[model samples]
Structure formats: structure tokens, C-alpha cells
Target: MSDTMSETNRMTETETERQEGYIPHAKQVDFSSFDEEMLRKTFPNSVATDVSLCAEGVLMTARSKSNDPQVTFNISDMYRAAGYKQTATGSCVPFAPEDVKTIVLKIKGSTSGLLEFFYATGSLTTATADCSVTGSYIGGEDWWYVMLDLSRQRNGQYTERFNNGCRIDWSTDVQKGDTFILGEMLFFSNRSEGKAYADSRNKIASTTIGKTGYGDDMPAEGVEAGYYVCLYQNKLGSDAAGVSATFGTTGLEDAISFCNSRKQLGYRVSDEKGNVVYAPYTLLQCDILREAKYVTTYARENHFTYGDAPINPAINNRAKKVSCDRLVCWVMYRVGFTDQPFTQGVVVSAMHTWSEENGFIEITDKNDLQPGDIILVKPNGSGTYALHTFLFAGAARQKGMYFRYDHGSDTRIMSHQPNVQELELPGAPFWRAYRPVATATNNIYYDRYYAD
Candidate 1:
């Protein structure tokens, strides 16, 4: 948020940094220390007099007789397209059209006028734009974060014509003295690096899954092709209703029963004196448990049962029994990290080894874990290395503990058995965590089809 001249200066990446896939581009434009010579070198076509650096950001003032003021960013060097010359060279490598996913802009100005964006194809002087999107400002003085999803643009061929650069057109509603400020402009690539992967995972986790099913209502395009779990494939049978049934065992069902018995799991637990007591779970933990329950129920209901197949078939095969590792694979595939339930070994130990060999970095501290991180558990009361795998949902009800979406064991026919449980972190079984390297790929389950 700092508008300091030094902080708003353009970022330059070295050859090694560009080669390493660093997203090299302009961070902010400081008008206060405006350099007309550098602006000409960078944009070439932009009018230096149209904008000035303000205390907040780059402020643009409407010119007399021009109702629709605009700003142009000639970013030919940042994109690979035909018929365009790079105004500034050697700064960074141009990205392919498909590599770019979204364009985010932070702006604040007139609330009445529309802020329009246009992506020019071959030339900026063209009468028509290849693609365009319209957005509104937040009015007042608050910044509005507007996101334009390039993939959803009307012109599918826009990528081919991405050479001319892009323009922002303010609506004619502005008067001569009307003004607006451009805070930031960022172009996000489709490549599965840290930010891109985290954004995709967060979007999927928040919008795709519901309390009742695992993306049952999600569009086919929203899911990774070939690994799409159809609505019919996610059936929570009567076994889901058995959570309230008495079970002498101490696994998933028991956990759910205990949670139900004391509504105090996620809420604050108070003493008889009505004094403040410890809160076992956070509200986020409660929401995670609700969603995890549905995932567990669906896995138990639809996985390939014993003797149902020679081996566990692909998830698309609509088999009925899913092991803990396969369940993790399903979660990853749903999150667009893999194509199918991981093609790596089906056993927990082999998957754990594959994770280590691949770009999955090990995390010894549980506090470093994120919501979508993969959690590997050592066998309880034994020396077995990796006996189970699940996702680190989020923080648990208890302090210093986390929640996990676990498909407890391989297929079991018992109606009282819970395939998945939202368990506290490192309580019953010690856990080792692995954070996936989003950009890394391998011949096994880690493929670029989903990541890209």
C-alpha cells in the first residue's frame, strides 16, 4: 500500500531469475518521480502528461474536451504475439498467451463512470478490440480490486492477437476535473507456481465443495478432465446416518458421536461456574468438519468394495472402495493438481516415498502447515513409516492442533464404520507433513495437464 517512489519503482529481473520462471513485470508506476524518458522507453505510446504520481498512487486527470480519458500500457515484452515490437528489451521473457490467466487491477475513482479494459490484438489503432471487460470503481476513496479472467474472454482467438498491448478506458461520465488513481496492476500466469496454485486451490475449496457433496453440482469444465467425479459417483448411503448410532470403536464414527454429544467441540466450552473456558475449535474448523464429513461419506458409499475389481480402477470407473491414499489422490485431482486418482503406487508407503522424490517438501513443524497440505501419518504404536495419508483441513478445535480429512482405512463394509474423520492433529497418531511444490512435475501422478 506504500506509494513511496522507491516502493513504486518498476521491478527488473535478471536472466537467471527470468529463466527460473520468476514473474518479472512492473509492480507500480510512481508518478511523483515521473521519468518521461523511462516512460517512453517502457510504454512508447503512453502519454506522460496524462498521469502524475500522487500520494496514493498514479493519478490520471481528465483532459479538456476529452470525456473518456484513458491510460495505455504497451506490454509487448510481457507477451508473445506476432506483429509487435518490444519497446523495452532484455527486461524479461515474453509469456505465451496461454500462460497468462488473469489480469488484476487496483483502482479508485469516480463511482458513476465505468472502467473499461480492452486487449488489443495486432495493433492498438484498430477500430475493434480483441477482447474487452467492463468494471465499476468502488467510489469514494476505497480501492477496488477488479479481476479480469482472460480465459473467459469472448474472443478465444484473443491470445493469437495479444501483441498490440492492452488499454484502460474510463467512461464518458467524467468531467474535465474528474480523476482516478491506479494503485496496482498484476498479470497472473496459468502456470502452477505458488500464488497461482494457492489461488486455484482456495477458489476450489471455497466454491466447489459443499456440506452435502464433493463438487456434485460443479460444472464439468470446473473439474479436471478424465478425473471428473460425476454426481452419480458421489452417493452417501444410509451409513452416513449411522453417526448417531452407538459404536464401541474409537475411530471416525466415535469422533463424530463425541462431537455431536458435546456441541462444545467448535464452540467455547465453559465451566459450571460460567467462567471463560478453552475453545476447542475455531469456526473454520467447524465448517471444515462439516464438509469433510460429506467427503468421507461419499468415499465410503462409492469406493470399490473388496473383490469388486482386480485392482482399484480409476475414479471414473465408479468403483466402491477407496483407500486412504486414493482418497488423498481424489482430493488432489479435484483440486486440479492431478489428472486421476494418483497413478503412483496405491499403498501409503509408496505414495509417501513418491512425494519425497518429487518436489513435495517435508515440513517437520505442524505450525507451518496450510489448509491443503498433505499429511502423512506413521502407524500408531508401531515403527511403520507411512501408514495413512490425508489432507490438513485447517486448525483443529484445540490449540496447537490441526484438523485432517482422513479416509481412516481401506474399504470396510460395516455400516457404523466412518471412512473419513476430521481428527485432531498428532493426537492419536504422530504425523509428518509434506507441502507440494506447485510447479514441480514428474512421470508419476504429478502432471502439467491439470496444473496448467
Candidate 2:
């Protein structure tokens, strides 16, 4: 982006005088009702000429130049930075720096570019920002969320710079004529709250329902309740005694013992400091489902390419084309399973070989299948090998023998189908199942049979 300004390059004479005698205000700015006046005041030093308010939000057109374009939001008013607006008539409330942990930006209709965030004090023309973060955005017409973590500022000394305003700089990767809509802007006190807000708007479905052995159907014997039980016990500590008791287990140890007896098919346990202590299944199925939602949504919205060959020209597009194997590898990598690379020409056989090389064990019996397991479809004839592969979501609702799975294929490049759905195959024997390994390091799990 732009070079850091020096004190000599501060604001104009009039603006500098206002800054010198300025008194802090406890009033906040209402972003929902943001108008042209508010927009101009927020970015007094912006060089772009075409900044206006649209139905979606604020619209800004990048100027053609060598230096990167920038839009800085003046947060000298701590209340505004904290996401609280001053009423027409009410007591002025104050917020400390620690009260806000992240600044979230909702953006839409932008070209491929790098968005960088920085914190600055004093005039935008002169102040130097010591803290900076960069995030990438794909060129698309859909809305996406960006969150900047302020908690990591200056080794957790973010509170010391509470009054510093925030600046957003866009890299030249965003073309000159490209335009983007700046939607709702807000501040949250924690990462979970920010993520929740984005997840709500993004329409991410919950993975807790429709599972046989989890959620509301958790057994009284606590056999299939390992995920929730471990999560609660780790989060609650001694307070988890009641939860364990209610589940017919004495304590965390009892629940863990039951989980271990099932061949590490339960949830992974993490310590208070966020370190993984016991990882049953490489990662939680719920986490895998969450990442799947984002990946599928992104691919559909961005019109991801589709190809099968090693060096297909169609794959050269801005959003590279991917086969079913590439899609599966992408989802696994997103959730901390980085054993394989996202390469072209990755076929079902490659995945099978990779699983074998890793600790993933083969499961001949369908009853041993669990959520997040990889199932390779048996070849059509005796001459060929397994051709199609998918991620098992859960057992289907029907009694006979059907299962839900998340699938990705050349046909689903633009379609939203194969989004955690169930399909009736010829029979269960048509597919070969592979269970992930369980270890404290890998955090894999494999559970057998759904009990009533």
C-alpha cells in the first residue's frame, strides 16, 4: 500500500488545528444509518473520487495508480470503534480497548485483491501503524466477511493503543476500474461473536442434527456421547461433574474410558490452553462439516472451474478447476489434515493410496463406518479399480441400509447439490470404507455400529 506518512505530511492546517485542540467524544457512529456525511468523515484522507452510498452499502471505485488504494476509518471516537452509536438523547457510554477484540467488514462485488489492515493514531497522513494484517479476497459478485484480530496487537498490548483508528489498504491486484461494495461494518468483543455473526449471514447449517449417536439421541450409558461430553467437561472443569452424572457417567475419566473402548471414535480433547490432548478422529466431524459449508459455498459463488486431466487449459482460469479428488483434498486440508497436497490429476486411486500410506485403516464391514470416513466406490467391473470417493456424513434415516455423504464431482462444479445429502446406492457392498487413525497427534477416530 501507500508509504507511511511523516509528521511533516500531516493533515491540512485547519484539520491539524482541530486535531491539536480536539477533545475525546464518548458518542458513537451509527453504521447502519451511515450516510455520505459519515462516509466522508470516516475517510477524510481518502484519495478516491467515486465514493458513494448504495442500496447494498458504501461503494468505492479504485483509482488507477502505482501505489495501492486505501480507505481509512477514523476511530478516534472509541465508542464508534467499539460499535456503539450515540442516541439523540442519552448518557454517553465508554468502552475500553479490551472490550473489542475484532473489527469485522462485510464486503461484496470485489475483484481479486489483497486487503491489509493497520492501526494508527493521530492524523491519517502522518501516523505510522506498527500492527498490520493481510487477508485475501476472490473476485466475485457475492458478499464475503473479513475479520481483523486486534487481540494480537503488540504482543497482547492492544489496550495501550485503544484510541488508534483503523486503516484498510487494497493491493494493486484489484484492477483500476474494479468496484466493490462495502457492506455492514461492526466491532465484536470476541472471535466467537464475530464468527457467529458471519455464520448467521452466510447461512451455515448446523451439523448437530440428523446424527444417530450424537446430540438429542445421546445414549444414557454415555457410549455415543463422547463428543459433547468431552467438550463440556473440558470447558466446565469441576462444573462438568453434573453433566457427567446426568449422562450416567461418573466423571470425565468414565466418559473417556467409554470413548476409548470404542476404538477412538469419539471427540478429541483439548486443554484450557487450546492444545490437543486426546485426538480421536483426525478432527471433529462437526469441524469438517463447517469447513465443507464454506468450501462448497465459495466454489458455487465463484464459479470454480471443472477439469480432470493433469494440465487441462480450463484449470488455468482465475478460479482453478478441480476434480472430485481435489475437492476432497481441499476440504481435508482446510481442517488441519495437511497430509496431502492440493494437486491436479489427483484421482480416486491416489486418495486410496494416500490413505493406505497414512494411518487410515481399511474397513471391510459397513457397520464400522463413521462420520468423516472416506468411502471409495467399488469399480464397475473386475478390470478397473475404485473410481469414485466421498466423505460419509452419517447413517441415513431409512431402516434398510443407506448413508448420507458429502460428494464433489465434475458435475457439481457449479451446482449446489452433494451438500451433505443421502443417496440410495445399489447396495452397501458397492463401496469400500476406510477409517481414519486415532492418535494424540493426528486426532483421528473410528467408531463402530450405531446403537439404540
Candidate 3:
């Protein structure tokens, strides 16, 4: 055990056996500054469906059964590219569950014994996946709300790993043109804290299905109408998990001819480290992905400019038009950081104001970054004239490292692959990192921290 942030997840029982908890020396050793060639050789191209890096000698791989479709996947050095083969493995993303106290999924369908869902620890394939089935029932005519408590032990399965992600396993009963809509799924942290919310649904018609220890309140008036256009439909000829089909919303259908759209491979992210980096919280990360998809398809539909802010995303829900900074802010607000500086907010004195006055602390050392921390960006040589901001997905560099993001590249959302140390930061070329210190406010994600 070292003072490194990994202490939280890497501390071993052996260290505890000594009675004196051990923490290794703490020093900021910039690995990117190390010989780039040697670093590459040391970290050769390897693949894991769920990959996590530790500073010391431990390279952890979360495994699941690997009965993958016969399609071959082209793996590469970027590493993340390996996780992109949804067609082959049937990935239904936007299924990030970054740990939450509870997961509530509501669905409507035609038939049921149990609203069975397939969940795996690794890729849906047989090699690494830890697959299992859970049972739920239809409440009213065809609706069911499944709530799960992660705080208490579940299934009594003596395993330490938590499920990464899950999606509905469409049954043979499902036929083309049949209606199967997944209403809103809610992921909330501090589940025991939300018992009052559960009580509110006591007499509600929608909760009749929730008699299962997990809260099941589904008042018709309370439950928002299902987004019919957005609901999942069993299109003809697309029964294979990774098979494709096309459907589109009316708004875009008219704008872009609601042309054919394919199905999500339905791969949900799983968190094996107990890092709370998957599920409920991952759902927020999906917001970033969803918004990015919107921008990719409709960037032309939006107008971009600095100084202008998108309407409160909680209400407007999407950035109609936005500058790079506004896109970051819109996402922060929508991810449940309802406090200002983000929600219903605007840029303040460039990025520093938010990092300083608001609760975010700018990181002086890149190694200190945890997931959800943000790195600031500006045009080359554009000192203090900070032009952009995006969520930090992970670190990939040793010196001033190359990090990744599913966010704004320039003005439009794209993949993140920037070196913080390489970016221009006014004085020297040092990168600036800022993140809200972990704290709970009326907002749930008030101070989000990745697994330490």
C-alpha cells in the first residue's frame, strides 16, 4: 500500500496481517517522461473486456464467460478500440452503472414469467463473462419495476465482484412489431436515505409490481409517459443480439428522414473492482455519450459560440447549439451537479473561476486525477483564453499524459486523446486539472470522484 490513490482499491489483506497498515513511499513519478519506447514495450498490446491499471505490479482483468459471436475483432494499441466491437459482442452501452445504492428499471411488454435480464462481468462472450439471471414480474397489464439494493449482500454469492452492466434479454416471446418499452430507469446513491421516496409510492398504481423489497412505486400520473418514439421495438428480422435494425425519432426523422437506425449491442459496463465506477453512476456517463451522439449527427443543426449558454439541460435536456465550454457545462448540470457553476450556469473568468470559486480544485499533478475529474483546454498559445472543457475519462500518458474522453474535441463532441502536459496553459505548458471535492449537496453528483 502506498500513498498513491490506488491505496483505496489496491490495499491487500496481506498488508493488514502486519497489524500496521502499510503505505508505500509517496512521490509524483511522471511515467510519460520515462523512455516512451520502453513504456510501450512494458505495456504491450493486451486486451481485457474490463481493464484497469494499477501503478505497481498488478494488472487487473475482470473476467466473464466468453461465448462470443464468431466475428473476429481487430485489437490495437489504443486499447479502448478493443471495447468497440459491439456488433460482434452485442454491446448496449449508455449502460454505465458507476456504483449507486439502488438501480430501478421499469419496463412494459406483452408477456412474462419473469422479466429476465442477462448480465455479465466481462464481454458477453464466454471467455470472460460471468453471466447470470435475475427474476422480476409484470405488475399491471404489462409493466414491471425492478429495484435492487447493492448495500446489502445479494444472492449470498460469495463473490467480491459487482456486476458491470446489464440489459434486457429479449425472449422468444418477443416478435417483430411487438411493443416493449423500457421506461425511465433510475439509479440513485444513498439508497437507505431514499426510503422516504419509496414510501411516497406506497398506494401508487405503478408500484404494485414493486412488492419485492426494492421500491416499486409507479403512479400513472407520477410516472412520465413512455417516450413512444424512443421506446425499443422488436423490428422484423433483427433478433440476433448484435443484429442491426433502423428506427428514428420524428424530430430527426423529418430533419434527417428518421432513417434506419441500428440496435444497441446492449452491452452494459460492469465494475469488478467494487469501485462504483459502473452502473447507476455510469448512467450519468452515458449522458455524456448520448449528448455526443446528438452532436455527431446534428452539429450542423446547432449554432456554436462562446459566452452563450444552453438552457438548463435538466429542462431543455440537450444542447441545441453550444460552444465547447457550454457543452461541458450542459453535461455537468445534466449529470446531476445541479449546483450552479454548472446547472443553469455560464462560464466565469474562463475555466479558473469555476475551478477556484466553485468547489472544483485544479490538480497540480496529473497522477492525482480520479475519474470524473476534468482537464481544461484552450487553443495553442491561447493563454488564459481558455476555450474548452470536457470530462476526463482516464489517463494514458506518463509524462504529461495522454488522456481519453467521450467529449468535445473542438466544438463538437468526439473522443478525448489529449496530453495535459502538451496543451498550452499560458505560463508554461503544464496541464490544469479541476474537479469538485467529494461532498453531497441537494445534487447527488455534487463532488464526483472516480475509484481512488
**Candidate that would win on lDDT:** 2
Question: Runs in model 1 with CA error above 4 Å?
Answer: 1-34, 41-49, 65-67, 77-93, 110-112, 154-159, 191-452
The most accurate candidate by TM-score is 2
Tens digit per residue, CA lDDT, model 1, 24-113? 542222233334443444443432226665666567777642435676655554222211223243213243455556655666775334
Candidate 2 achieves a global lDDT of 0.48
Q: Write the per-residue lDDT of candidate 2 for residues 1-452, one digit (tens) a residue.
A: 01332322233222323543221221223344576666676666665435677877777777753235776665654233333343222211233455666656677645544466666544466535576655433346656665555655676664444355566675433336667676655566766676566565661111111112222223443132222223222111232211221111223453343233322122333222223345445445544544454455566777776655353212232445665666666656555445554345346767777777666778767677776777777564662457677666554323553333333554566654333234335542345766655444443222211111
Candidate 3 residue 282 Cα shift, in angstroms, is: 9.9
Provide backbone clash counts, one per model.
Answer: 13, 8, 48
TM-scores of all predicted structures: 0.34, 0.36, 0.32
lDDT of 1 at 151: 58
Comparing 2 with 3 on lDDT, the higher-scoring candidate is: 2
- Model 1, global lDDT: 0.44
- Tens digits of lDDT, candidate 3, 274-393: 111123223334344334334333433344333354464334535454555555555455445555543445552355665565576778786675455556655346466455565564
Error of 1 at 252 (Å): 38
